[model samples]
Target: MRIGELARLTAVSERSLRYYEEQGLLASTRTPGGHREYPPASVDRVIRIQELFAAGLNSATIAELLPCMRDVDGGPGENATPWLEQELVAQRDKLDRAIGDLERSRQVLDEVIKAATGR
Candidate 1:
């Protein structure tokens, strides 16, 4: 399929798909007319990429991790390793800390709102 088809199937913008290719998170072949062509499997790949991004992984990190994942379910592939597991654990911990901080900030905001409302 073409880039536009992939974009429509994945519900991602053409610009984002191009950016994914540029970031090495996605792949495509160029046609004779210089248009981008993608394999049918790119749909699942794009979904996996979105999932990783949603999990707070950066493009570079996702690039390294992609080889270790199955496109269908984002499960570990043969290339998965203990080091990768450790890296994911660290990222999860960082997210946990950020969540805690955000919760505290929200509590403070709630208290301020309560006071301002005199209730």
Candidate 2:
């Protein structure tokens, strides 16, 4: 499919798809006229990229992890290694801490809201 179709299917902007290519997180070939032509599987790849980004992994980390992941089921690929596992664990820990902090802030906000409403 074309870049626009991939972007629409993944609900991502064309600019982001270009950025992903530039980041080496995605791949594509050029048409005779020089337009980008992506494989159908690119849909899955883009979704996986978005999921990793949502998990707070940077582009560099995602680039490394993508090769180690299966776009279909997200299972570990042959390239998956101990060091990559360790890095993912650290990222998960960071997300956990951020979630905890956000929860505490939400609780404080709830208390303030209750006080303001005299409830």
Best by TM-score: 1
| Model 1 agreement with the true structure over 1-119: per-residue lDDT tens digits | 99989989999999999999999989999999999999988999999899999999999999988877755755557787787788888989999999999999999999999999986
Q: Model 2, range 2-82, lDDT digits (tens) per residue?
A: 999999999999999999999999999999999999999899899999999998899999998888775566665778778
State candidate 1's TM-score. Answer: 0.84
Clash count of each predicted structure: 0, 0
In model 2, which regions exceed 4 Å deviation? 74-76, 102-119
Q: What is model 1's C-alpha RMSD?
A: 2.0
TM-score of 2: 0.77
Q: What is the C-alpha lDDT of each candidate?
A: 0.90, 0.91
lDDT of 1 at 108: 96
Q: What lDDT score goes with residue 48 in model 1?
A: 88
